[model samples]
Target chain A: MKELQDRIRIDGQVIGTQTLKVDSFLNHQIDPAFIMRMGETLADKFTQDGVTKILTVESSGIAVAMAAGLKLGVPVVFAKKKPAVTQDSETYLADVFSFTRKEAVQISVAAKFLVKDDVILIIDDFLAHGEALNGMVSIVRQSGAKLAGAGIVIEKRFQEGGKKLRAAGIRIETLAAIEYMEPGTIRFAQN
Target chain B: MKELQDRIRIDGQVIGTQTLKVDSFLNHQIDPAFIMRMGETLADKFTQDGVTKILTVESSGIAVAMAAGLKLGVPVVFAKKKPAVTQDSETYLADVFSFTRKEAVQISVAAKFLVKDDVILIIDDFLAHGEALNGMVSIVRQSGAKLAGAGIVIEKRFQEGGKKLRAAGIRIETLAAIEYMEPGTIRFAQN
Candidate 1:
């Protein structure tokens, strides 16, 4: 986690007071080795939860989820923003509003992937407004699967997403928790 | 490669005559460990090529690219189907027509990720008409990077993409090359 924080400080670009661009290593252009380390840290937290599957919403979450899934030795299922031609008709759907894109999109996972006997760990690249996290949670609930928790790479602590999700009794863990940010400065939340 | 062909035959769902859905492990729902094996196989094929970076498009390709990058000990850069808010303004772009989605989409990579000195190996989940492959090849060329070649998990050999790209002097290696497919059968192309 410390390594992730250090890397974020070194490579993350702060735009305005809200956006942090980690495109160099996290979101767009990924550092696979670094991400694998982050994923191991996340998977370590939920190793004893009997997680049968790792769930995430694409396109950013896929890399982290894949790494975590490999670490946890479980299958990774990514919710699609739009159903592809090969997508199954039966699916659990959730609506997510993206603050960055300024749009609402539906994310869905095929029904066959998640079942009542499954224990799901939701993973993603960032947790800000919690729309995407909440959407995955909703889908997990719909499938009647036991929720292990959520593992996030980065969380905006200044935002209410983490607080609200914690208040709702959902266990959430983040590698880097950003307290606040300016055009050139980023502050991390102290434990 | 045999394992991949065997897995495809067991898990892939052939739709009509042209589509084979391996969503159970390759795309929608991914088996990370299995993909890591496929990645190793792909990476093995190009181990002597001095691949400096692994490139792919986002969503489906991220998992395999991450795996391949990890195996190759290189950074993986995924092209965004649509530029995100954090995306760089300066980019190398190309238009790709999706046979499955039935629409054309522009994929772009941040110019900083690919440089003239970088040797790129494009990785993807599927190659049908070479639209996506061609798009990434174009981006790599735009950046003036030397291309090692492409590593695809599956190639629809019945289609013209593989032949066309090979004819153009691009080295392509596929784990499973499907010669043809029907509602319940898939035949692999013999080397």
Candidate 2:
């Protein structure tokens, strides 16, 4: 966690007051050692919860999810943004209105993947409005899976997503929480 | 490689004539141990090449890329499909026409992450038409990077991608190459 916070502070570029671009390492260009370390941190945080599956959204979250999944020794199920060409089955769909994309897209997971009696932990790269997390939680509920908790690499605390999830009685763990980000300045929340 | 071939035979499902769905453990829902093994195998195959970087596309490729990156002790840089709001700098963009989606989607990678001197080994979940790999190769060429080769988890030999790349003198190593697949029947390439 300390390493993550330090790397974020040193490398994360805060853009336009809210968007933190970590493409240099976190999401796009990845530091696999750091990713592995991050996974160990997540495992240390959530492995005791008896989590059965690690769920995340498509694209950026896959790397982080895989890292955490590797450390936790669990299967990772990433919600697909694009529907599978062969998929035409009745599925659990959740519409996540992306604050960044400025549109709502339906993220789905096959019914067979998520089933009842499964404990799921959701992980992602960034948490802003929490729409994606909300979508994953909705899918978990629809599948009758237990919500173990959520782990995020970075959380925009200025945004309401992390707060809302915590308020909703969901246990949340974020490696680095951005307390403030403005022009030429950034602040991190003390653990 | 035997384990991967065995896993594919057991878990992979042929959706259509072209697509083999290994959703249970390869792409959608990932088995951590298996992914690690696959990565280790890829690393073993490419260890002599002096690979400084592991490259792949976003979404599904991130997991396998991370795994291979971990084994090789290098960073993984994924070409993003549709740059995020934070991404606006000059990038090497390619239009990948997907027969499954019937659309040519643009995928791009930042210019800074990949340098002229870097030796890159591209990794991906599957290879069918090789559009994605081709695009990555193009990106590498544009950046003046040395392309070590590509490491694919599964390659559809019936498709022209593998043949085309190998014909183009690119080193390609696939864990499992499906030479034939019929309804309830599958055949793997003899190594």
Candidate 3:
């Protein structure tokens, strides 16, 4: 976790007072070794939770989720994002609004993947407004699966997402929690 | 490779005569350990090529690319797909048409990720018509990077993509090459 924070401090670019661009390593251009390390750190937190599946959204979350799934020895299911809703009885659908893209996308997982006996662990690249995280949780609930908790690579602590989700009794573990960010500075929340 | 063929024969769902749905293990839901094995096999073929980076498109391609990147000890860069073209000078873009979805997507890689000195190995989940693979090849050429070749998990040998790319002097290594497929049967091309 300390290494992640240090890496973020070195490579992360803070935009205005809100956005942090980590595309250099985390999302777009990925450092595979570092991502595996981050995944191990996250999987270490939920090792005892009997997680049967690791859930994440498409695109950005796939790499981290794959790494974590490898470490956890579980199948990783990525919810596919569709621009428009498609009626399907064999899938579980959840609507997520992206604050960055300013678009509403429907994320769906096939019904056969998640079941009541499965324990799900949700993982994502970032937790800002928790829109994507909440959407994944909704799908898990729809499947009647037990929630083990959520693992995040980076969490914006200044935002209300972490607070609101934590208050809802959903256990969340973040490798790097940014307390605040300014145009060239970032502060991490103390563990 | 035999194990991959076996797995495909067992789990792959053949839709009509052309489509092989491998969402159970390769795309929608991923078996992490199996994917890592597939990546190792792919990377093994290019171990002598001095691959500096692994490239793939987002969503379905990210997991396999991550696994391959870890094995090759290189960075993995996933080209982001945009429904519509955006004006960005810092990116290299290529238009890809999806035969399955019947849509045109612009896949872009950041200019900073691929350089002339970098040797790229493109990895992907499937190679039907090679639209995505061609898009990646275009981006790699745009950056003036040397391409080692492509590693495809499954290649439709009956399709023209593999033959066309190979005819263009590109080396392709496929774990499972399907010669043909019917509703409930699949035949792998002899290695």
lDDT of 2 at A178: 86
Off by over 4 Å in 3: A83-88, B83-88
In model 1, the Cα lDDT at residue B182 comes to 95
Model 1 scores a C-alpha lDDT of 0.92
Each candidate: what lDDT? 0.92, 0.86, 0.90
Query: Candidate 1: where are CA atoms >4 Å away?
Result: none
DockQ for all models: 0.91, 0.87, 0.69
Kept native contacts, fraction for each prediction: 0.96, 0.96, 0.90
Worst 10 residues of 2 chain A by lDDT: A35-44
Model 1 Cα lDDT, one tens digit per residue, B27-101:
899999999998888999999999999999988888989989998999999999987776677899999998888
Docking tier of model 1: it is high
Which of 1 and 3 is the better model by lDDT?
1
Model 1 chain A worst lDDT run, 10 consecutive residues: A182-191
Worst 10 residues of 3 chain B by lDDT: B82-91
Q: How close is candidate 3 to the true structure, as a TM-score?
A: 0.97
The complex in candidate 1 yields a DockQ of: 0.91
TM-score evaluated only on chain B, model 3: 0.96
State how far residue B10 of model 3 sits from its true place (Å): 1.2
